[model samples]
Target: MSTDAKTFLLTGGRAPCTLELARLLYHAGHRVIVAESLRHHLCRFSRAVARNVHVPPPRQDPDGFLSSLAEIVNQEKVNVLIPTCEEVFTLARGSGRFPDHCRVWVEPIERLTPLHNKWTFIQEAGELGLQTPMTWMAASHSKLTEILRNINGKFPIILKPVYSRFAAEVYLLRHPAQPCPALSVSPEKPWIVQEWIDGRQICTYSLAFEGKLIAHCAYRTTFTAGKGSSILFTPIEHPQLLKHVEEWMASKKYTGQFSFDWIETAEGKLYPIECNPRATSGIHCFGESDRLDQAFARPETASLILPQAGVQRMLSLAMWSYGLFSVRSFSQWRNWIKSLLAAQDVVFRWRDPLPFICQFLLLIYFWKQSRRHQISMLEASTYDIEWNGEY
Candidate 1:
């Protein structure tokens, strides 16, 4: 390695996006280390990762997680510590614990909390004069029922938790055909009901430094595991989308990842729906060939870069399991096949193929976790690190 090479420590190594980021950083002449709570993670066997350091689960033991990260930073001399998943909140909550030499790539908990919460994110965006969905919060079951009754004859609405991910527990109240499902909402665990707009859903993933966007990509999932988690990611960049995100980030002066979901109308209007203060699948859109990897390598001064055109990343296993069977029309099948043939499997790199073979064992781990806890595989995948105002 060159003398100028910096060591990067990344948490949430299980995510495919995180694995891609590790590959990017490593390929950019930087040493890569992963600190993960899960033993059987995607990056565990990747050649891109120099070392896989097992750390305590942040949700269960934030103190230990912070301590372990601090030790890793001090010992490995990690130049940057990036939390790629929901554990970013944990890192933010326990800030100023890492060594002075290391730069933790996360904002303070106060700045991130509102952004992570579905209700507060929209509210804050609206307060900033941004276009947001018509949203209402219900702190109790009765309040939710009342809101539903008031909007019973109105347009369809999206009902979800104030803090959620992967579209978990999100319900679409369409019309008389679908009855409202009973929910256990409370003041402690509030939910949101928002007017569902009829438009194309566009998602943006970005990295901002001192409130300036450094890396960004706008994409839409052609295939999702269910109604929520995307399995196939295809870039759909637009100037309007880029401008919207730039304005949002510039206002916040954010220093970490900020991913948002928006509803784009036929006339090119975008309604901000939700924000995730961590890395998302859009990171996979970034390739080393684009030189966008240099942004993370030296975020302080790197100019803005985007994912080069004609980039698509897919989880083939996910597509096989959740995508193929869902295809009802011939056109959908054709699009699916076309994307499958064109896109690269995020896990199966020619130079680093161990992760591809080891991933079956990782799926087995998630399966056991799901069975043991009686939760869905999606829930099990994030159960260890999900921070929902528990602090």
Candidate 2:
């Protein structure tokens, strides 16, 4: 083992972002162990991972998940434990269970999970000195109906569950008179109605230590799986934008991975939509380099790591399957070609290629899960790990 290298246990090995992160850490001379709920995942076949541990799904069995994680930390002598998915919430809730030697890169549930809540995040972001979209929380059917009546169709509105991933439950209201869909709106599963902004979607993925930023990357999604969840990340550089977002996060004294979704209007004003306080595809915008690794491993001495210029990343499989269908016009086709030419597949590496080959198996896994659960394939992907205010 390298003298400077540390053993890292990263959760959510099933996610492409986690696989890419493991590659970055491994390339930097650190040992990476992946803990996932699924029997098969992308990292299971990757050369970057040193070990793969199957643990109970964090969303389904929080106690069992924590016990397995604690055992892994003590036995493997993990130096750092990073949660790369919604599992972050469960781990954050049970953070004290781990032994003393391991440093878990997550905030406490109280400080962290609030950011995951759409309703609270907007209010909190405003207090923290960031522009946020106008949002209203509706905890009951009566409240939701009243909020819709108040909107009066002045402009478009979007209703989404306060705790949802990938815009899976998003509903767009084009007119105020349209009857709202029947939804479970209660204290336990509240919804937020946000004023729709016409602008470019600018998303960020950042790693912070204490109140300071270690690495930051802002991206405008080029291609997406559906309405949300970008498959291609086009890194953009705007000093002023990055500065404001970084200062906003620094004000929270935030630690761990803090990511955001923002709407940048034609006038260049940014309105933050929600916060994910966990890893996102923005990780793909970065290369397998030591800067990000050093930032996570030794944040004190590490300088801010930014995305490499002119670099774009995509899920090549999605480009063919989902992106191809997205093209409807000649201009769209041209842009699609440009994006395809400019970006590299996030998974495929010429030297280390087994993981890329095995990605098909992971797809099959999701297919089986979707069929068994009678849900959308995208929902099935994170069904086991996604969190929604379960205590």
Candidate 3:
């Protein structure tokens, strides 16, 4: 640790991206304090962690939780408050409660609310002239039917909640014959139905300072599910995408870390999915590009440097980690083997392997837990609900 280290308080410590962010900051000689809503996996993986406080769970008592966090920020003399989860609005809205001495990097409340709301985000993007998917909001069964009839949607359409955290309740109606069976469509709680564009999924990671894009990078997701982080990624350059990014930040007056997802259609058109106003899962590619250090050193630095061929090597190392857990299917085993061999070609280096090793262990633990029915994808939200009354 360095003597002149600054402290950063990170929320949602249990998220892997949050832990990785802490590791990057710690390696850059910053003292790390994690204010987590849960102590399970985060407490286990942080090697350079200075302190870990379990705040009131987010969903239960957002207001009280922020108040408690405000007190901690003052006590710890935190230099920056970094939130990694969907509870960003909760913290940003309560920013005034914290002492002015602490700098919380969040968008203004007015902007934060609309940014998190999917429908609002789409409208805002359209207003800003950014290319976004054609989205229609349906609040009732009649509206849903009407929207479906009017659009005459093709076989595959995506149905998602107006305010979704990750891929919760998102479904793909693969064919018209399989019209979305009325599960539950509240008039007040509308759902978004959009043409499911076929294209490669790419995520752009960026940081803004006073509405200016200071740091940016884009990566293609090689393998991803609705909820999990990308298993593989490749860095790429798309100037048009960057153009929309600059316009978006300028329009929103965005400041702080944020990410936007895009789908590059077969026709070479880019359609914006939505914006995540915080750090994203694909940020690991920063380390691979050797630009991770620059983000910590200078917040104003912005560049889109592609990763060297060494990325494959890093993927191989990751695959080796997977193989240690007895990933046995022929295709699965072969993929791991390919990654192990490919890792030899990458230049990205893990400064500290402890956290990565711990992450691998946790992945295996969760996998086993799933097989035993201890946890289900749909039931994951219950964890937040359990603390609802506690706050």
Instruction: Write down the RMSD of all candidates, one decimal each.
Output: 1.3, 1.2, 4.9
Clashes of each: 1, 0, 8
TM-score of each: 0.97, 0.97, 0.81
Clashing pairs in 3: 60-388, 310-345, 310-346, 310-347, 313-342, 313-343, 316-339, 316-340
Which of the predicted structures, 2 or 3, would earn the higher TM-score when compared with the native? 2
lDDT by residue (1-391, candidate 3, tens digit) is: 5665678888876566677677667777788888866545543545757888878876777877888798889898887788777667677667788777677778766767676677888898888876777888988888889877776656478998786655666788887777676657786577889888899888888877667776677777653433534445555677888888888787767787778888898898888887778777655555533645454445565453334433432333333443335455788667656655554312223644455555445555546555666665433522452221011
Segments of candidate 2 deviating more than 4 angstroms = none
**Candidate 3 deviant stretches above 4 angstroms:** 1-4, 43-45, 153-155, 226-228, 288-337, 340-375, 378-391
Which residue pairs of candidate 1 clash?
211-253
> What is the TM-score (0 to 1) of candidate 3?
0.81
Per-residue CA lDDT of candidate 2, range 166-220, in tens? Answer: 8888999888767788899999999999999989898899999888988899998
Model 2 weakest 10-residue run by lDDT? 288-297
Per-model C-alpha lDDT, please? 0.87, 0.89, 0.67
